[model samples]
Target chain A: MTPDKLKTILLVEDDDKLGRQVRSHLTEAGFEVDWLRHGHDALAADPSQYGLIVLDLMLPGTGGMDVLKHYRGQRCDVPVLVLSAKTDAAIKVRALDLGADDYMTKPFWPGELVARVNARLRRPLANAGDSIEIGRLRLDQSARRLFVGEESVDLTRVEFDLLLALARRPGVAVERGWLAEHVLDPERDGTGRTLDVHVSRLRRKLGDRAVCLQTVWGVGYRLEPDA
Target chain B: MRLRPRLALTALLAGIPLIAGSVWARSAIERSNAVDGLTRLVLQRMLDGGRDECSRWPESWPIPSGPGMGPGMGPGMGPGMGGEGMPTWEERQTRMQAMLRGGGGPRAFSHLGPPVEFFAYSADLTSRNRLAPALHEDLRTGLLDGRKVVSRGRSNDSDSPLEIAVRMDWFDEPESPSAIVLARQVGASEFGLAREFLWGVTALVSVMLLTLLLSAGPVVGRARRLTRNVRRSATDQYATSIPVEGSDEISELALAFNAAGAQCRAHTDLLEQRERSLREFVEGTTHDVMLPLTVLQGHLTSLAKTSSGEQAATLRDAIEEAHYMTSLIQNLATTAKLEAEDAPPRRDPVDLVALCERVVARHMPVGREKGVRVEPVLPGDPVVVRGDETLLEQAVSNLVHNAVRYVDRDGRVLVVLSAESGRFSLRVLDDGPGISPDQIGHLTERRWRADDVRARHPSGSGLGLAIAKEVALRHTMELTLGTAPELGGLEADLQGALG
Candidate 1:
């Protein structure tokens, strides 16, 4: 399916102007956008109806962390994208720990916002079967091989781990820390910047398929399936 | 010796001589008078005895006559009396000498003695010729008158002594004449007594004068010394204390002076302490208040950007109101701080050009929106100076903001920075309605707004220039508010620090 064919998104923002702008842009990207003014409103909305949620940390009535706590308390499995003007690292880690799928700071480009939303909607593919397919690209967990339309592609250890993490999720976004913890070994010389170098290296190897990796400024990277 | 002793000695020296002279003169006069009286009485008695002896003779006696007596046949003749039954003239002379020598003749002759020599002279020319011519003439003259003659006479011979002669005529026989002369060696014993008396009086007077001087010397000297010390202490500026060694009025004066000095010092110290505390309080309050204000300004700027239409307009109005209120509070705080004594000035090296540029940047957006141009004339080199950076920045910002707010569309606001003589100066000039002469005086004062100028642009808090002036003063710098000569608008020149 095309990336624009994704449906259902949740936007949580306290600021009236920014929230409205974000909703309009996400709706224009062919996604059903449900907008809420604060953390309390987002928590009250039916979590199952939305595939993804854009949550702001600073919200009147109830703070974003409390909303995240409530969503996790209800065992809601919907993907959550945390949004805020707070750029501190501690705040991002806390949100991600509370089951938020990703985080973004304010003044972010609208295109990046749409991309992040699409990536969150695609997160279910990682748990579906262990084999995932996107256009000519295919990954087989059992074989440990990645093929582009019957032609096998070669990748380094770091590049293979990076591609698997993204290929498993299909269209979901993965934060920088998540990639560093799961794909990159702590004993090795790899870091967050190392992950980016590997991503760029992998994209170079994938060639025309590099459009799948997107940078969501102030947020982390996301993988988007081609339209 | 000291002045007191010297004065006493001088008094004694002058008085002792005068008293001694008076005593000596008095004693000498008394001794001479007593001696003179005794000599006169003794001589009279002697003469009277001689006359009595001559008168006792009977008329029948034959008396030797030379010049006064003629031939006479009488029982009392001169040769008859010369026999052993009566004392002869020589024998009488000897007895009289004995009487005078014994000092037993009379009470009137007390201390007087007999003459040292005696002589008799006859009235006959032949007897008188044998004597000295002066004696002979004196004897002849006395016999011719038949009168007793007493005269002090000196002999022609040097060997002979001074003599007193008593010549008397015999009354029994007129022709018979005789003179008795009694003389004594002139002894200095009587005059010596008078001289001794005078010397004794002089000695006594000198002793008394010395005693008087010695007794009065210390008292006078002490008094004079006290006067001098008091005068010297009064005129002395540094050593205003008189030594209080004794329980006297001078000691009391010293104590009073010391007490006065201590009181003055205490008062001065108290005033200084109070002034210092007041300054500290003002400085601390100003620092605390500025932090909150800056935060508030940042929040407002963010708020203004998010709202739209009337909401945006309302937010802008709120922000402006807040800015005005904050400015007023800042100005009031600064003014109060300045009025405090010994306020600690916030001094640091600051770049004037950079400071002015920052202020211009803060106001430039607004200026551009209003179609007013903000021209910053920054120096090529960093114009560094020592002053309070925050206050300087605020002052420059105030001037720039005011320019942008008041000037007409297309009007220019010029911020010029320059340095000379180790002093950095910043001037903000605008082509707007210049401040009137009357308003300039009140512009720097707290809450004093020019109504005429403010009416044209009521957005300002009217405390910008006041705060600027106060900040300038605190840094020991100058802030002059006037009309720019070239721009024909308000000009604020704040000069501080050295280049």
Candidate 2:
């Protein structure tokens, strides 16, 4: 995708009121949004020009599912966030199975919609090669090491993966369920308590710099760049 | 009293009287034939002139009364006859032997069988021989009536005797009637053929009854099978029907049962179709309501963001009210989904930490606006349990929303998550005034709220905690409420197994 595409979003919604609100919210969140009311218009648009596409499942003239299928058929890898008024799990699962990245139900907060859009737009940090630097801590991806100031801190395999998972999306809170699946060692139990143990130990090792690794309450951990 | 035993009992009850009647008839005919043979023998002997020779041969012989003698004449005219000048036993024996040898024409009693014994008596019973048994009352009455009297002597032993007695007229002198008595010992072999015939009849009757009972087995079994099939079909909502086995009444009953089962199945199908349509309508209405609710929320949010001071606060309350309506609609929908008998709650792994975090985040703005400090003290890692993600999220959200709504301004609402052993627990505690002990039990009751709560938050749906309780029960978790020991407020705690 082009660098400008990261600032652009494609929104396809049929409900006039909800569609206007979503477009305005995205715009107010500093995104360039292309709003379309019909699924056919979404199908005609080049998906590659947009970094994130917010598609509503209910649309006139060829429904949203057809447009989603068409884009996925063309191998358009842009993130698609499905918006629906249906609360049925089967429909949500079907949308996710059809290559939708996220699903948001109706009556959603405008601020929440903006947050989800930005989260999707943030590129996965695995693509960042070699090293990643946030605050005084630097994560060497290849070497599998974390350095706090001049001292190189030692972390276990699970601790490094946990820290790396949070560090990937600096300010965004990662879900503990996702972290438990992706960060914990496959051979271990990977229970919540076990994950908690690793985090506490990692915090102890981080010492004064542990402030950067903030807990997002009921969510998972987040890493903030210290000024 | 099943079919087999009932048939056998009826056969037995009917067979007993028939067997008895047949036995009595056979014995009567046999006795009559024996009496006839004896009568012919005695008459033939008299025709041979043995009675005339024996009558004058000796006075020991019982004879018809002479013309001058009557029934009142003094006894001593024959042996064993009581009189004033009765003869000695030896003398009588000599006279009896002389009379039998002297009898002319044909030897007396030469035609008689050795098994038989005979005696003669005068019409008044005053001239009977010593060997004759005392006359029975029934036999005596029969002889007086001029009918032959035949009887089996009363003896329990096998060698019991049978006697036949009949009145006879001599030389046409009916007034001087004399009777002859004959007796013979009886053995079982005497009626061996009759016994065999009777045994055959009894065997045949028994076989007939047994055959009837045995044939009823399949019918009884079929009836039992129909009963079992009816019960089984009921459990499966009448998906199966009974097999009609015969053209009899049982088969007719089976046909009737099958018809009834078909009707039940049709009714069940109709009910299921109605339920599915109702679910679809509810989901459709929720979706329709959600669209407008979202727009109103968006408008209220923008209005709140643009306004300042008291106006902004009022808009914020409006936004909060809008959010409450959205949640209320969602909760009702979830309750309806849970109540549907066919749809069981999904068992997917849900992270309680993430659930609590999102809930706290959603209510944090309201908490901030209310000056309530909504804090979350979660375990450093995730606390995942097996449940439906949406339901658990909603349950936790309700708990936090209730806490934020009820807690006084500047009060603290603590949402804590912890994992111990293999189980995960969540506690939402607020430092507001705790409920009375009486109200704790009714906290989860649908549409129930305290009087004070109704006055304070009139827009509250009173369904949040109820929904949470239902979600907890469906997931096999325990949701308990009590006073928070440290926080001095209402505490809601939910605990369940790890996913």
Candidate 3:
């Protein structure tokens, strides 16, 4: 996969300096990032164009919860990761219940934030059929088919489980602990390093479509829908 | 009556009889002296009149014979005696002897011995007579003067002639000597004057006694009333209060008592106000401290969630510190709230066993990390109590936290909740080094630390048990600390909230 093919993300944050720092980091990581200072601007823009939305809960003009409501209400279905300074469980539950794809308490690591955004954008489209599509990539659950722009690719059982985990919620970061618990056998002591090896093998099988599998530093892998 | 007035009245009343007796004695002495003087005057006047009459009537003139006459005189007399017919000296002498002796009739030559008796009178006055010769001489001198002599003689049987001295002055001047003598005796009436003087003196004394008795009545009555008023005022001032009706001393005393009572009430009110203000100050200060402490605790919890590596370690320490500060502030607030006079417990029915289990679970993580085991012995049936749920939770949490923090890693901490009789008890027992007998004395004091224990461990702000103790007291429950039997560590028991 080439760096130019990486999907763009819109980051809405009230803290100006922290937002710029995060944008620069993501930019340097070979991904285009657009930073919005308030929730209103993020909600006004076409959120469908962006691969992912990273919303800060405490924002001016409109709150993260309100932006989430507006997006979900309109059925835009853009993956959103909520960031907040409130660590209380009730707040996290409320944010999630309000259609926020994921919740993160601050002062969160920039790497973790990027990883979650990547994972959220990579989530596959929901349908009753066996095949799942996220942008140009598709996985046929029954046929065990993987395609990148209409060409089919074969995957092993471990590769399929890994891809399926990432595809279940595209563009949302799946923590190594979650992957290990859901994908690997319990008897296998598969560390995060081992999960990294499996993701690398899966990325090589689908060329150019491999751009969706993004490496978020100091955190687990994320899959982004191709832009 | 008061002592002073009663004393004064007694003195005044007593003075009356003394004054009356003194005055009566004085008057009686004066009357007796006057009587003596009148008697002397009457005797002298009689002697002088008799002598003058005898001398005026040559020898006899038949001496007056009425009640006013001389001693031997009779009612009837001869014509010569009536007319002042100058009878001779011998005849007059014979008539005088007849009058004196009554031996001779009213005729001439009554006795011839009169002349012989007169010749025997030449002897010395005291030598030859049983009676004094001077007295005899005086009687004779009065007869020779043709005066009827009247004296208080010793006896009539005396061998001495009576001498009489008489002057013819009044008889010749047409002033009859008998009339002069009668007038002198009436002027000098001794017995009648004495009797009349005594009657006048008795009347004066009676009047004085009556006056004293009459005046004493009102004076004594007024004094008694004044005394009674004063006594009542004094007693009322001490026991209750008296109305000041007038501007008298008793009224003044009542006013003073009222003023004193007012001052006492004012002082009491001031003291109560001061106490209330002090209590409010304490409550406000503690409440103010608690607000920031709660905010700090929240911030610490947030800090613990975000940090990593050494920063996480530092944040954890900060969180513990904040928690300690919150516990201390909460203890102070609870103490202040409980100390209020009208503090009412917010009681609700709660399951003691569930509460204890929750508290034990809260401390279980810390206990597990320290390798300590928390054993909760709960009743099969719920042990229900009517109490403040939050405060009771705080109480049980403190006990469990204390046990978890103090006991060794391998030690066991047991929490038991049960209902016995009508009381519900929640007890926490630990098997670490039990509190020493000496340390137990200062265990509940805020910030108290045991000397023998390691200082590195979480030395509680020492408010946990204190807060629990206050909560128990507020609920009208009992909280006690003792050594667990087999565990040999501190055991805290919270009992009551029965119904």
Candidate 4:
């Protein structure tokens, strides 16, 4: 099935304004919104009916943790994105440990929230194929090579891994720190600056098509389709 | 200066006078008994001369006048008279006086020791012998009143004479003394007083020291025990108190210490309670504040997305103000948590690599909006350090956020975590107009902003660097500020040991 096709999103939040805005945003993002104001209602509802659950930690009655625990206890595999005003790392870790798929601190942008919801509902990109293409920049995963339009681009192992990591999630900002640890060779100094070097070299090799490989500034790199 | 030595010294000091007084009193008594016995012995010897010698002198003899009693007559008219007729009264008297004065006349009593000599004084207290030794007036008066008198005679040597005078009645005179016998000890005693004094002092000191040791042993022991217990309690974090024993001063000290220890424990408990409540309040305030702020942010985001031109820009500024408020609240909460000074940060192994990532991620949107490029330079593997994760995250977040806030638009900010030479170094570097070297030192001062930023960023509380510095200090790490070597902007470096 197509990822955005008539999926239902369950939103459990206490604050009226915040919950309404989030529901409206999710609706605009082409998802059916089933909003609940209390944690008990969320717990009572069947988690399997929804494609995703947006849980707020501070809820009236049952509490978000309890609901999360209940859902997880039932072995429901739906993705849960925890929204909390408590920015403490321990709580975030706790929610994650309770099978939360994602965590977003409060005072977040509606746009960002919508993006997270969609990203969670999207199919795992690994199943798509061995290759990922964004505009003229294409990556062949099995062959470990990249191509820009009709010409093949030469890439070092580090540069290839960096581009492949970004190309897997086109238009989405990945953290530079994550790219450094995962894409760069562990034996080498895979620091953010080191990752930056690899990205720069990869962009240079992309030549005129380098415009499609975008830097997300405070975030990491993003592969965009060139119009 | 410690308890044992102090007690011993005090014992010695107190023992001195008692020992000296005992020795002095014993010596005085022995001296008096010696003088009395010597007087009796001398008097008995004089009396042992018998009735013939005692009756030789008439009851009230007239004074004898001598025409030639010089040295010439002394040799010719020897004490024996040399077979001549009995010596005249004048010659006999002179010879007797010379002998009594130890002038080497005749030995009237050969049985007595050589130092012994005596002569007679008439009833009127006048010596019949012209050369008799001069008597003290007190002794003479004491003799005339029928009282035996003993006195210590002043002399230039340590061996002073013990002199005595007694009444003698002779020739049927029963009511009054017809003569007085004056005698004195002429030689030192049989034992040297120096040796006696040495023995006395040695004995006294030995007894005193032994007594002091026995008496002060338990006191010192108790004092030592108290000292040890006090130290142990301190090492035990004042969780335990010294036991009180006995009714002595040491016990009093123990009681005082126990009270003080109890007070300290109570204060610690009160402080812990206060800290817990304060942390709760800060957390609650953070939650309450964030709820509204989040709603505000959502509305602003919606507005800015739909608006255009000036309206969009203003909405963007409003969103940034909300973000600044969020960060300020976070810093305030962190500051509140840090106020519990005695509580050590949680010792979980924190990954600096992930930490830098989260910090960069958290600030990414704001950085993108400001056109500032905030990035992380981390190691490939996790660089783990032991600390409280939340505090560490906040510290790093502050560093990155501060760099993003002050750095100009289109500038680059880097959060670099480097592990080299077995050391973990975290640095936040930016490529914008950096603080002057002078201002760098003040950057970490709470609420102190660079003079240049106040005009453009008037709302900046300047608490970011300060909070980061505090977190680093709590973790036993060093937070240093300087110009970035590569980026040429402000570089905040946190150096710590690799976990």
Tens-place lDDT per residue, model 1, B361-400, is 5455445445677766544356777665556666777777
Question: The CA-based lDDT of model 4 is what?
Answer: 0.70
Each model's interface RMSD (Å)? 19.7, 5.5, 16.8, 5.3
- Compute the lDDT of residue A38 as modeled in candidate 4: 91
For residues B238-356, write the lDDT of model 4, one tens digit per residue: 89989899887889999999999889888988988897896798778887888788788778877776899988778767877777887777776677667644477877777787567
lDDT of 3: 0.57
Give, for candidate 1 chain A, the lowest lDDT window spanning 10 residues: A214-223
What candidate 2 gets wrong by more than 4 Å, as runs, is A1-7, A49-51, A118-227, B24-114, B141-160, B171-194, B228-236, B239-246, B307-317, B339-499
Per-residue error for B287 in candidate 3, Å, reads: 5.1
Select the stronger candidate by lDDT from 1 and 2.
2
True contacts kept of 1: 0.00
lDDT per residue (tens digit) for residues A174-224 in model 3: 445556656765666465567777788898997877888875432345667
Ranking of predictions according to lDDT:
2, 4, 1, 3
Give the TM-score between model 3's chain B and the true chain B: 0.44
Q: After superposition, how far is residue B422 of candidate 1 from its true place, in Å?
A: 6.2
Model 4: per-residue Cα lDDT over A1-227, one tens digit each = 34443278889998899989988877877888999999779978998878889999988789999999999999988889899887676787788778988777776667657767655664344335677767777788888888877678778888887777666555554557667767878777646677777777877888887887777544456676643
| Model 4 pairs whose backbones collide | A191-B378, A192-B377, A192-B378
Best candidate (score: TM-score): 4
Error of 4 at B321 (Å): 2.1
The DockQ figures for the candidates are 0.01, 0.21, 0.01, 0.23
- Model 2: how far is A92 from its true place, Å? 1.2
Best-fitting candidate, measured by DockQ?
4
